[model samples]
Target: MSENDPLLNDPLLDEPQARRRWWKPSFDRRRILRWSLRGVVALLVIAALYYPVGMLLVHKIDDDPDFQAPATPEGASRAVALAAALIDREVGDYGWPSNDPFFMPGWALDNMPNYQQGIIAALARFSTEMRDQIGRVRGTSQVDPDLEKAAGQLSYSPTVWIFDFSTSWAPTASSEQQYLAAAKTLRSFNNRLSQGQAVFERRADNLQGTLDRIAADLGSASAVLDKQVEEHSGDWVDFQADDIFYATKGRLYAYGLLLRDLGTDFAPVIAERDLKAAWAQMVETFRVASTLDPLVVVNGRPDAFMRPSHLAAQGFFLLRARTQLREISNILQK
Candidate 1:
C-alpha cells in the first residue's frame, strides 16, 4: 500500500484506470456526464417527441372559475383579470406557456380568469370602436349575414381560458406541501359553497315552516274571535253586529300588523341569506372555476390565460355563465 511500492512502479500507474464502485453507476462517469452535459439536446429530443407546437393545448380538465373566486372585489378582480389577460395576450398566442419559461411565472395562473377576462374586455372595446368602420362599406355588412350575426352575437360573449396548474406541472416550494395546500384551498372553497347552499335551503325550509305556522295561528285565532263576536250578538243585536264588525276589522288589522312584523324582521336576513349571500358564495364558485385555465383560440391556436382578446374573455364569460347556471340550478333544487 506504500506509494513507493513495486506495484506502483508498473506502467499502469502512469495512467488512471476507469473504475466503478458498488455505490456508483457502472457506466463511465464521463459517459454519465455526457448525458448531463447534453442538457439542451435532451430537452430538444423531449420537445420533438411530445410537441405542443401544433394547436396550443390550452387546458386539461378546466374547473369552473366561480368556485375559485380570488379573495377580492369586482373592481380589484377586474384589475387582476386584466393583468392576467395582458400576460396571456402578450404570451399565450405565442405559446401555451409551452415554452415552460412563462408557464407558471409566479402570478400567471393565480390571476387567470379576472386578469385575462379584463384583457378580453379591453380587446372587445377596441374591436367595438373598429366595428364602426363597417359603415364605410355600403351593403357589405348585408352581404355577410354571418359576419353581421357574429358582430351582434359578440356583444356579450366574453371568452376566457382557465388552466389548473398543480405543483405537479411545475416545481414549487415544498411541492407536495404546496399541492396539499392548493387542494385544501379548493376543498375548503367548495365546502363553503356547499355549506352556504345548505344554509340557504335550511333557511328556506324554516321560513316555509314559519309561514305555515303563522297561517295556522291566524286561522285559529280568527275562528275564536269570530265566535266571540257571534256569541255576544244577542246583547244589542244590531249594536253587537256593528261592534262585532269593528272588532273583526281590528282583529284583521292586528293580524296584518303581525304578518308585517314577521316579514320586516326577516327580509334583510333573507336578502343576506339568499341573494347577496348566495351571490357571494356563487361568486366564489366562479372564482375557483376562473382560476382554472380555460382554453381559447387566438390566431387559430389555443392559448391559456393569454391576453384579453375577444376569444379569451368570451371563453371566460362562457365558462362563468356555465358555472353560474350550474350553481343556480343546484341552489334552486336545494
Candidate 2:
C-alpha cells in the first residue's frame, strides 16, 4: 500500500492513537488519589448527617421524666392515704363484725385454712400496693432517712408464710403443738414491732401528732392483752388460747407497723398541719405506751376447752385499733 493511501491516514486506521485515547483511561496516581479524597469527603458528610439525625430521633422517642426529683407535700399526703387505707382494711378484717363471716367462731374453726387464705391475700395485696406507692413517692419526696428505714423494715417478705397451718380444723396433737408454737412466734414478732416504734420518733418534730395517734392504738392493744390475762385466772385451752393470741398479735403488729411507717412517710405533711402542741402530746403518748409491754401470759394456766374469754382480748384490741385507724384516716383526709 502506498504511504499516501486514504485508508492508512484515516483516524480509524491509527492503531497507537486509538490505544492511548480509547483503550486506556487516564488512571494516574494523582487522579486516583483525588477521586479517593472526594469519596472520603462524601462519606464524612453522610456520617455527620446520619449521627445527629439518629440522635435527634432517639431523643424525641424517649420521653421518660427524671424520677429522682424531691417528693412534694402532696406526694407525702398521698403516701399517708395509701398507708391508712391498708391499715383500716387489715384491722377491719380481723375485728368483730368482720365483713367476711368465715372468720367467726363456728366457721373460722372449720375453715381455718380459708381464714388463713383470706388474711394472706390481704397481706400480699398490702405489700404490692405499698411498694408501688412508696416507689412513686420516693421519686418526688424530699430525702427522708427515717422514712427510708421504716420502708426497708416493712418491705420484708410476708411473715404469715412463716407459719404453716393444717388444712382442716380437725387437729392432731402435732397440729395443736404447731399452732401453739406459732402463737409464741406471733408474740415475739409483736415485741419486734414495738421496738421499731422508735424509728417513727427519729424525726419526731415532723411526725409528732401522727406518731402519737399510732402509739395510742398500740397501747390500747397492749392493754387489752393485759386485761384479758388478768380477768381470766384459772385454766385455759393451751392451743385455742394461744391461737387466739397469735391471731390478735398478728392484727396488732400489722396495724402498728403500717401506722408507724405511714407516719414516717407523712411527717412533712403532718408538720404542714402545724399541730405543734398536739404533736408534743402525741410524742408523750408514744413514749409512755412504748414502755408498756403487750403482757401476753397465756401458757401459765392449765389447759381447758375454748371459751369466749379466750378471744375477748383479741376482739378488744381489734375493735380499738380499727376505731383509731379510722380516726387517723379522717385526720389525713382533712
Q: Report the poorest 10 consecutive residues by lDDT, candidate 1.
A: 74-83
* Candidate 2 local distance difference test against the native: 0.39
Once fitted onto the true fold, the runs of candidate 1 whose alpha carbons sit more than 4 angstroms away are 2-6, 9-33, 45-57, 60-334
**Best-fitting candidate, scored by TM-score:** 2
**TM, every model:** 0.18, 0.30
In model 2, what is the error at residue 324, expressed in angstroms? 1.9
Error of 2 at 203 (Å): 18
RMSD of each: 27.9, 26.0
Per-residue lDDT of candidate 1, residues 73-164 (tens digit): 22121222222233233334322222233433321222223232333333332222223332113323322222222223324332212323
Top of the candidates by lDDT: 2
lDDT for 287 in candidate 1 is 43
* Worst window of 10 by summed lDDT in candidate 2: 60-69
TM-score of 1: 0.18
For each candidate, how many residue pairs have backbone atoms clashing (under 3 Å)?
47, 4
